[model samples]
Target chain A: MDIWFFLIQVLNGLQYGLLLFLVASGLTLIFGIMGIINLAHGSFYMLGAYLTFWLLQSVDSLLLAIVLALPISAAVGYLIEALLVRVLYRRDHLDQVLLTYGLILIFNEAQRMLWGGDVHGIKVPAALDWSIPLTDTLSYPVYRMAISAVCAALAVGMYLVIQRTRFGMWIRAGASNRDMVAALGINVNLLFGAVFALGAVLAALSGAIAAPISSIGPGMGDTVLIICFVVVVIGGVGSIKGAFLGALLIGLADTFGKVLAPDFASFSVYAVMAAVLLVKPRGLFA
Target chain B: MTTFIAGTGLHTYYGSSHTLHGIDFAVRRGETVALMGRNGMGKSTLLKSLLGIVNPRQGKVTMNGADVTGADTHAIIRRGIAYVPEGRGMFHNLTVREHLVMSARPGNDGRRDWTYERILETFPRLAERLGSLGTHLSGGEQQMLAVGRALMTNPDLLILDEATEGLAPLIRREIWHVIRSIKETGIASIIVDKNVNVLLGLADRHVILVKGEVVYDGSDLTPESEILKRHIGV
Candidate 1:
């Protein structure tokens, strides 16, 4: 194996992993903080992609499209929280699973109805369209590198927010005991709602960012959602730091497995998850 | 002697099992009210009812002259009530400092009486264990942290359910001392504990529940009185 070729694979893995972190962080937040198992989380990711595609067509700017699409996704999440998810907080996990699964179906059909059953892609913005030559025969896209950088920054931003800010304290407190935080005079319901909306924004932002790199179709979110669950499970359900490590580990494993043995590419990631669970059931960071 | 909290005709049920039966409870400004009852007699339930933790099927709760029946828990807290719930209600993952800082707000009554330094000064044990997580602390330390966290909210009324349920005698005495100092600060408090003698000394008024009804309400009774032996004795 050429060392340069291996380096390229590592870079690819980092990019993929960072994107997975963005999605999985949101999933973990929703599950960890609010105790809601939201299957429709992926729908927001799909919506982000579709909305980006739609918005870019009209605005012709990736940044502008993202700026417009995020708040919309957050609003949608807030509405869902108030109308549907709020009713299920005290309900059983099985009930939440059923309702969110129903949400997945509704969002899937909504995307199909609005955007039709066709594949779509966003053009890479000119600023990040350049590539760095790794070898005479190989070069890496600057956009991919930008994704990794953006994700790293986001990971740091998340850490600072959770560890340093007062809102983050409430979030951590809520994760531990919702009632205790409320008893402290914090509006736990409103906090949970804001968290749910933030999770949606993060998930949608991941999709918007990835639209240029991956194909967006009717079921684009389904595969990513399943993979995100794997990431969250391996990362520990509520820990953002855990999601970062888990995404990178899975990203590299999946990428290298695809390159080395296409037949077992999917199996390798699951194998890693199973092996991790066997050793530490809660997760690596939990 | 302004009324801090008043609940009348409170009837609460936990899934068809009636808990508090038309109980009337009140706490005056700067007064310490002790809620006493054996296990399952709705001692904690009454506290829950007053704070809107459990919605009373029939009741009128007025806090600072505002009707707050079935109000949301955070809303009740925002109205200047802080609760140290049963079992201490500690967050296992948060550190001692995090617990104190998470709920810190200037007193709604325009008094900044309880900053982190004042709390640390009050509970030196907490200052020593500032970085320790809630699960890492001993039972006594957790209780102190609970009270300290409640103080950080600078509440008009503080409620502690099972204020000192399981602790060594020394720690219990320390908690009683803390309560006494809190009383000196003129913050109204509602405490629930089994130590009747300690409460008799500390509380300005005592309300004893027998099977969800207030069987005794008085401040003048001595610890050795017939009411204590007949109703509260095991």
Candidate 2:
């Protein structure tokens, strides 16, 4: 491909990487800390997309829609954690898989019933619709850049919350040694509930924000869910820092490989994942 | 004496195999006790039972005379019982500083005595490794870190299950020195170890278990040496 095409694809890769990091960060944290594999995580992302679309249609104000959708998605995430994930806390992973897989189906059927399985595209409220010129003929969308910027900001926020704050300390301690943390007097069940909810909200936010750029569909979350698992495995099972680096690597590789080598594109991401796994079966940073 | 903590008729099991059998034990406000036994003597099992890590089938555990039997580990910790479990159980990802921060007692109290300065003074080696991860430390240093982490809680009763299980001779000496100092502070501890000499070294009382039953209990170590050889085959 030409230079402009390559540059745009690189930009697209970064944007996609950031979004994946956001979703995978939650997945990794919940799985790492709670030791529960939630297959329904992707549904949060799809719900976010659907919520963004609904807000856009109903609210009419693009900025207002974006602002309102975040909290709504967060609440929905809280509900999912409260209602479903809580029950699977001690059950085997296979049970969690079955229940959450069942949830994915339920969510898809619900979305189909409520919104209809139509591609309801989101309009980039004229304000963010413009593009920055990378070349004479090729341009990168400003909105996508905004997604990257916002995701970076959130990553920083998450780092601060996990590394510096009291809650963050509790979480890391609990994740590492549940018995020790409890013996130190932390109400672990309550903590896990909050963490699961927060993870859900973030996952939904990724889905919502990416709605305009990525098409809205029933199976969107399933594809992202698989990628999130790969991302977490590649980054290290439960490390947020690992998730960030891993997402960027996967995003860049998947994007570039697709554009430059169509034949190898589909398998390149897994190839990178396998290589990372080979060195550290626990992932690069678990 | 402060009725700090006690367990009565504690019994437990692991994967259908019974381990602890109705063992009664207690720690007062400020007393250091040692639990000595050979391999598979249920010392660790008793500690786990007290901490709620191992569920007691038929017993009552109380803190300050308040029933806390079957209470979760978090609640037990909040009630002021810190345990340095077997193997140090440190979060290898966290640095020494991070471990201290994470180990701080959340709702413990107004007593601000065991500050960072004092802990660093007690274990200067850990002070140097404060920036290092848990896995980066030597066995002795990790043991010290575990003690430091437990001390940060300023616990009413600190239970050390095999605190010096595997350490170099010098580090072992340092750990004993640390334990002596901790005892001097008037905080009670239940130390489990195979070293009869160490148990006799700092403990005010001795309890040895054989196949989950307390075969010996008292301030006397008269037959403990003989008991250790026969039971532990030391």
Candidate 3:
């Protein structure tokens, strides 16, 4: 491949990896801390995209639509945790799987009922409509770079919240010992609800931003959900740092695999996961 | 003395096994009560039942004249109670500083008596290793961190279960010294330990359990009392 083509591919891989980090980080947090195997996590991403699409009809700016849609996603998450997920905390993984899988079905039906079974497209905002020229003949879209930038900034913000703040400490402590946290007079249920809502907001933000780049349609979340699980498994359950490196590895493998081995494009991601698991049964960071 | 916490006729079970049966326990303001018994004799069960960690099938747990039976653990704890459970309950991911800082809060009566500085001052050994993870600390240091973390809440009531279960002799003495100082500050405490000799001098009252029942409840028993020798083997 030419130098410009390889550069473009690298940027594409990085951008894809950044977006995956936003989604998988939430998955890892909810799984690691709350111990909830939330298969419906990807549905939140779908909701964000749909909400953004719906909001854009009434609002002129895509940025404004996304800003408004995030909180709505968080409320939905908090309500799900309060009304449904709370019951599954003491239950077994089989029960959690059944409930969350049932949730995926419910979410899919809700999406179909509200948005219908048609694919939709969103226009990149006017401010980011142009492209940066990589060569005299080839150029890269500015919106993709903006998405990468936004996701990177959010990643930093997440690190600060989880590592620097007192709330973050409680989360880490609660993950280790729930009974001790409660005995210390901290409201564990409220903390869990907040963490779930935050996870929803991050997943939704990824979807809302990616909607302009990818075609918004039914079952989009299913593919992303499967890929996210692979990321989590490869990185180690509940480790944010693991999710980050794992997402990048998968993103690059998937991006480059298409060019290197077009026939085994889909198999390449799983191949990497299998190889990683072979060396570290518990995962890279576990 | 007014009652800080009282559990009446507590019957707690684990699966088909009955753990605590018809146990009535109480701790008054500024009083230290040592809960004593052999392993699996329901000493921990009584503490758990009173704190709402386990639901008593038949009991009433009251704090300061308010019935708090079947309440959430955090809700019950927020009523001026702090617990240092068995095994120290350390978070391997959190530093000593994070563990203390995260749990720091004013008491239910809005008294910040045990500030972060006060905790560090009490456990200078902890101050020296503020950045170490809770699990990374020595057994003694972890026990001190557990006690310090509990004190950081500025609770009116403190419960310690096996606070020095596995520790060096010097560390155990240090812990007992801190416990003595904590008692001097007028906070009510419920302690469960194997050290009957130390507890005999420290606790204001002693409640001995035998097979899920309170065999003895009084303060006048001497260290060589038949009750302590018979039930605790100490």
Candidate 4:
């Protein structure tokens, strides 16, 4: 066991954990706050990557691509929520699953049709192209560290919004009792739309930031979506803090498992989830 | 003396089972009305129907001269109606303060009387538990929080279903006292409870339901009245 290799893997785990937090946080918000089991959430992440890809090519600026992509993703989320997800409020989980599954199929095919079947890579911003020497032989990418910083800032922003603003109160109240919140004269549908849009933006941002690190391709969202479900379940469905913690745990487990036992790496996160569920069935924070 | 809100010819159903049949009820401005009935007689259903929590298959509900029948719950509530539902409907995860703050709004009539300080003063027990979670409070405390939460909305009409159910004697009296104080503010109220003697003193008029039908509606009856015993008593 090389100590330097292990330390590098830990840094990699932190980077991966932060990225997972961005995606999983939105998943928790959409599921917990709006009571929608949206399987199409990952589609937003994929769309974000593609949108950033297109924008970066056209605008030739990473900052502009990010700025434009947020609102674009949010607008798409608003339309989808109003037109389709709104009808599913009174519906059972099975109906939601069927509809969202159908959406996943549509999104997957659409990506394939538009972008072709080949995997694509995005260049890291010129400003963050440097690396920091971790050991005598190993160096860590600055862009990965930047992902952690941005995710931390977003986490702080989310906490402030949820804890301080009137909008946040409505969300907290809605999460507890949708009917009661509506009866109190807060337009829950509007709140739902806004929260869904925020979720879309967050998911999109996750993809945007991660584009430089990972390959962008058709069906890229499927694996992330499954991992996020595991995160939400282990962290407690509605808790942002829980999602953050769960993501880190899975990130470390996945990173270390690969080096310790390569064959078990793929299933390690699931194993953690299973153990967490056995003790706290509702999730850690639920 | 004006009718603030009224529901007429209301027929509501839960899936295939009809819950309320042709129920007509009204609450006037500054008046206190008691809704009385046995279990499953549709007392709660009528309240829910008024707020659009459960839409009636037939009939109309008019509020402030507007036909609000089948309107969305939030829309109805925004029109100056607040409800304290049965089981208290307290959010298990929310703190007592959050419950109050979330629902706080100025009254539609331009009355800004029910502020946080006023609500806390009215229900001091709630003030002490401001930081406590809704699930942590006792039954009486939960009831107080629910009422305080409704008050914070500063609504024109406050409807409380099962107002004092599952309360101790002292707590029940305290609740009744608060209801009377609320009545003094000239806001209409519809209270549902089984404590006939206590309700008779506070409510200006009584509306009784028997198996989803109105058996009585008048102000002249008392706890000992024949009409009350005949319909409500076993």
Candidate 5:
């Protein structure tokens, strides 16, 4: 591939990598700290997209729709945790998988019924829709770059919370040794529930933001969810730093791999995972 | 400031293995009481039962005259009972300061003031490394942090199991310093430690268990007291 083509592909990968970080960060936090394997996490992403589709039509403004949908998404996330996820917290992983798989089905069918199977897209807010000039006949959409920037910001915020805040300590502590936290007079059940809600909100926000660039359709969440799993596996399961690096690596590889060998695009993503596993069985960051 | 925190006729199990068999025990308010037994004699199991972790198959647990047998862990906590269990149930990923915050309840359980700032003052080693993770600390520091966290809850009774099971002499002494200070605050404690010498010095009364039942309840201990040597050490 030519150098210009390679650079463009690299940026494309970065964009994908950034988005993957958003999803994988949530998955890893829930899995690592809470010991929960949340298959329906992607459903929250789908919920965000569907909400975007409906709200965009209702308000006729992408910014307003997203602004309005953010809190609503957070609330739905809380409900899902309180009603569904909490029930599975103490149960075996096999049962959690079965229940969350049930949630996946319910959310997928629910999204289809609400928004229909045909894909839809929200117009990027006018201010963010313009492209950044790179070369003659080569311009990148500002909205896609915006997705990368927004996800990057959230990642930084997540890092700060985990590193600097007291709640972050409890979260980390609860994940590593919950029994100790409980013994320390911490209401560990409350802590775990809050963490689960936070994970859901992140997944929802990722879906909402990506709506302008990607199709907001029935299975949009499923596609992203699989890619997110790839990100987490390549990062370590509970490592946020791992998720961040994994997302970027996967983003770059998937982007370039598709351009270099269209047939090997999917294989290339798995290939990187296999190669990383060979070096560190957990992932690049785990 | 403290009164009776007692478990009467406690029978508990983990799934199928029945562990605590009709064990009746009580710690007087503002008293330092020890729950002692050999390895796997249900010492930890008794603590777990008190926390409502494993429900008693029979009997009642009362805290400050309230029947807490049917209460959930948090409900029991809101009733002013704090538990520090064995093997240090800590979050390895969190910083020291964060550990304090996550455990801090809004307002005090009953204390007028038991602030996180006060905790840092109590454990200066933790203050120096405020951002360190749980595993990064030495065994003694982890134990100190555990006590600091329970203190943060400002409960009426602090239930600590195996608080000094494994530690250097100096670290154990440091823990004793903190524990004595806690008693000065008038927070009652049910402490499970192997050090009979320390127990005689600190505890107001002693609850000795042979198997799962209370074998001896002794009181009025002095430095010269040798009555505890047989029941406690051997």
Candidate 6:
């Protein structure tokens, strides 16, 4: 393969990894801090794509659709936490899995009823519908580069919030001791609700951005959800830094596996997870 | 003095095993109370019941005459109570600075008396190790940080459960010094420790529990008292 072609593949891998980071970071946060295994997390991604698609029928801008859809996703997430997830906090993991698995079925059915079981594609905004020339016969899409940049910026912003701000401190502290956090006069229930909503918004944002490039259809979230769990397992249950590295590794592995060995493409991500776990049984940063 | 917190008919349990049996406990404003008992004597359970950490099967917890039984722990804590739980309750992920800053809040009456600077001044050892994680601190330093973290909340009441447990002699003295200074600053405290000698000098009143019941509650008990030997085995 040509050097330019290799570079383009690497860029694609990085972009894919960054997008995965958006979804996985939230998953790890919710799991680590709240101790709730949310199987319905991916449904928010599907919901985001559908919400954006439905909004585009009335709103012309993809950015505006995302902006409008985020709070709606957050509200839905908050209500779910208050109504459903709160009860499971005191319950065991088996009960949590059962309830959230049921949520997945409900969300899938809801999507089928509302959007129909048909493939749909989102139009790339005209402003970003351009390419940067990398070679005489090859070029890279600016839209993909834009997605990587936005995800990267959000990652940095998230790091700063988790490290520097007071709320972020509570999140880190809550992950270790929920009772002590509440003893410090911080309302932990409200904190968990906000965190769940934030996770939904992140997953939704990933879906909205990726919609322009990929075919949006029923069960789009299932594939991504399984991959995100791989990312989380490789990264560690609760470490954001681990998630970043894990996502990039999985992205590059999956991206290159198809080019190098077409038959093994689907197995490459899990193989990487297995290899990482062999070295560190608790994950890279658990 | 006004009662800061009062628990009456508190019957707490853990999975059918009775812990605090209709315990009547109270702490007055600006007073230091020593909750003394041997291990498994329900001293901790009584504190947990008052702070809403463990729900009592039957009881009423009142704060300043308000019926606050079964309120959320954060809501109850927000009324100007801070707890340095057993084993220090340190968050391994947080730095010394993060632990202090995260818990910093004004008192319920809006008093910001316990500022970050003041805490650092009080515990200069903590100031030197501000960047270190809680797990990295020495056992003595962890106790100091725990006390410092509690003080940062500017609470009307500070609760320390085994504050100096498993610490060196020098370190235990340092914690007692700080607790003494805290009482001098007029913040009420509930201390549980094996050092009855130190508590004798520190606490204004004493309440000792034996097998889920208070066998002694008085202000005049001393090191030589027969009750201390019978209940605490001191």
How do the predictions measure up, each by TM-score? 0.98, 0.88, 0.97, 0.95, 0.89, 0.97
How accurate locally, in lDDT, is each candidate?
0.91, 0.84, 0.93, 0.90, 0.80, 0.94
Query: Which model, 1 or 4, shows the larger TM-score?
Result: 1
Candidate 2 chain B minimal-lDDT segment of 10 residues: B104-113
Ranking by DockQ: 6, 3, 1, 4, 2, 5
Error of 5 at B215 (Å): 3.1
lDDT of 4 by residue, B84-195 (tens): 9999888876888988888888888678899999989999998898999998998999999999989988988999998889999999889988988999998889999988
- The TM-score obtained for chain B by all candidates, in the order given, is 0.97, 0.93, 0.98, 0.97, 0.90, 0.99
Ranking, lDDT, top scorer first: 6, 3, 1, 4, 2, 5
Q: What stretches of model 6 exceed 4 Å from their correct place?
A: none
Going through the candidates in order, the fraction of native interface contacts each one reproduces equals 0.95, 0.72, 1.00, 0.81, 0.63, 0.98
Scored against the true structure, residue B64 in model 2 reaches a CA lDDT of: 82
TM-score of chain A of each: 0.98, 0.94, 0.98, 0.96, 0.95, 0.99
Cα displacement (Å) at residue A13, model 6: 0.7
Candidate 2 residues A1-286, lDDT tens each?
7878977888888889999999999999999898889888999899888888888878887667767877877777667777878788778999888988998999999999999988777877688999998778778889999999999999999999998987898888778787777766778888888888788888888988888777898789999999989999999989999999999989999999898899999898999899999988888788
For candidate 5, give the lDDT of residue B158.
84
Pairwise DockQ winner, candidates 4 and 6? 6
What candidate 1 gets wrong by more than 4 Å, as runs, is none
Q: Candidate 6: which docking quality band?
A: high
TM-score of 3: 0.97
Q: Which ten residues in a row have the lowest lDDT in candidate 5 chain B?
A: B105-114
Q: Report the Cα lDDT for residue A76, model 5.
A: 75
For residues B116-177, write the lDDT of model 1, one tens digit per residue. 99999989999999999987999999999999999998988889888788899999989889
DockQ for each model: 0.87, 0.55, 0.89, 0.70, 0.54, 0.90
Better of 1 and 5 by TM-score: 1
**Most accurate candidate by lDDT:** 6
Clashing residue pairs in candidate 2 (N, C-alpha, C atoms within 3 angstroms): A182-B74
